[model samples]
Target: MTEQKTPPPPQIWPTLRAADARALIRFLVTAFGFEETVTYGDGDRVDHCQLSWPPGGGLMLGSVRDETDDAWALQPGTFGAYVVTDEPDKLAERARAAGAVIVKEPFDTDYGSRDFAARDPEGNLWAFGTYRGEPR
Candidate 1:
């Protein structure tokens, strides 16, 4: 008998409707290093879309309507996402060039990591930091 292919791991996808989803997808890819997996929608409304890092889940973007109650879609400028990176300084520079507002300059943390944060056009926060502590 032939073996069936295993499905990929499930991911928590967040939906937003305050604005166009395509624009967000593009930003995530270029700024955050996420890859656009797939998108679903019509001429002007994006029903849902998936985005992630090359190897696995990172982020998902989608659209919403007045009838929907997804918490993620309700708040446009109040959401933030933190991600770890190996080069916080370089990522900060890239983010600045991509038009993201630099909310915090790169700084070393007591936790032994160089970290910095930025805000996108939609007000989503992106944190890039490097881990400097040895494994316990």
Candidate 2:
């Protein structure tokens, strides 16, 4: 049998703030298939959380707090990100079935990539596509 290697942890982490962090996390997992790695906080307030995309990379999020209470004051519903996926159509279907709002239907791009866009419950725009970026 061949050996398998685990990919290294993501170096850059996209971050966001949510009015209802717990609910946002649930929606992300149920709709987009993000893996909830860890969460910290008390009650409904999420101080910090990490959700990992299966393909690679991940994102961090926390509950929205008053600007005076926290130094990083990211407003809810103001985050956007593009994620690479091999099956945008299938993912879009899953996301739709999970009550995600499909902002853009699955379509082919002129640059040779399948893509789709959706909005989570908190109104974060997420774009899923097959373009893995240009070669480094």
Candidate 3:
């Protein structure tokens, strides 16, 4: 009997809508250490942007809608995402120094993880921790 090939696991890429995408991109790189991979559109209107986390994974974002364009846009802080990192304290410190809003200081979780939460310039909540979910 031939063995069946298993399908690939689902990828989770967090997407956010920023009021000022141009500025938000800069903030994300400086504060959270996300490197810009690709950006679409121009000027103040950002159609899509892909950023690479320092460790792994990716984040996508776009600019807020204009007065007449009513597609789908999330208000800042309306969504939250967790990121796995090696140093939560250090990461939090870096973010704080870069002017990110530190919502929760780094702390040891009962689940055996050190984590911290912060709000981006556009008020997007982000959590960085030592906990990397199990891979399928």
In angstroms, give how far residue 75 of model 2 lies from its true place. 0.5
| Residue lDDT tens for model 3, 1-136 | 5553643332678888888898999999998889999999977888999999866678898887863775665775687999888988988999999999998999999989999999987787899998776533
Give candidate 3's whole-model lDDT: 0.85
lDDT of 3 at 18: 85
Q: Per-candidate TM vs. native?
A: 0.75, 0.91, 0.86
Please give, for residues 9-117, the per-residue lDDT of candidate 2 as tens digits.
4478999999999999999999999999999999999999999999888999999999998899999999999998999999999999999999999999999999999
The residue ranges of model 1 lying beyond 4 angstroms of the native Cα positions read: 1-18, 67-73, 131-136
Distance from true location, Cα of 108 in model 2, Å: 0.5
lDDT (Cα atoms) of all candidates against the true structure = 0.69, 0.93, 0.85
Clashing pairs in 1: none
lDDT of 1 at 42: 89
The residue-level lDDT of candidate 1 at 55 comes to 39
Best lDDT among the predictions, by candidate number? 2
